[model samples]
Target: MVLQRPAAPDFVKRVFTAEEPDLVWAGDMTEIVTEEGRLYLATVIDLFSRRLLGYPMGARHDADLVVAALNMAAATRGGDVRGGIFHSDRLNSPSTRPGSSPGPAAGWASPSPWAGSARASTTPSARRSTAY
Candidate 1:
């Protein structure tokens, strides 16, 4: 059977930093091994503050996990994140789409993740510390 794909998102990309909060957010998923099993961690970080806006963990790295993190980020900001952008590397991932997919509502813009921010340290200490 062929699986149907959702329409591409409409959000456009801009220079990485925003003048204020909520303008742009980046989402990423990582996996960790534990005695219990493999745990997937989905995270949403606010670009302006480099703050860990939201994160949700689950056994699988799927739409549900990322959506939960989006929901948490939205809820953290009072749930009115209509004009904000949510960037992610997984452009085709179901979690990056809205509506039929398991991500935030269409109100959010999904742009390809910014490379600069991805490599830079969000923590001041990490940025300042010397690397051996």
Candidate 2:
């Protein structure tokens, strides 16, 4: 059986700018090749400061990995990410699934805070870097 992914919300609307820190954030995952094996890296960044708020490397690119990064980001900001709009590619993970919640403690409201398309252009230039 074939399953279709839900549509992503157009919250950011291609606007990747923020006046202050924590106002806007973006996250994405990438695959890395090493002699040992492949690794997945998830990251969260602040649009205003262009600072890497959270980044976690793991063997699988799933919701857990994304959550870890987000949690780390929240911890970095003193565990309060309220009012922050986190935008990310349409990751086919439970954490980003429409109507799904990343949990209350995740600091994000229900329905998740994910946005943007899989298209590279939809992501910010800074996040396009392959380098960790």
Candidate topping lDDT: 2
lDDT of every predicted structure (CA atoms) = 0.57, 0.63
Candidate achieving the largest TM-score = 2
- List TM-scores for all candidates, in order: 0.65, 0.72
Q: The CA-based lDDT of model 2 is what? A: 0.63
Candidate 2 lDDT for residue 111:
43
TM-score of 1: 0.65
List model 2 lDDT by residue over 14-121, tens digit each: 888888988887888888999999898889898899899888898775666666776677778876565677778776654445445332223444343344522221
- lDDT of candidate 1 at residue 18, scale 0 to 100: 69
Off by over 4 Å in 1: 1-14, 91-101, 109-132
Worst 10 residues of 1 by lDDT: 123-132
How far in Å is the alpha carbon of 65 misplaced in model 1? 0.7
Residue 29 alpha-carbon offset, candidate 1, angstroms = 0.3
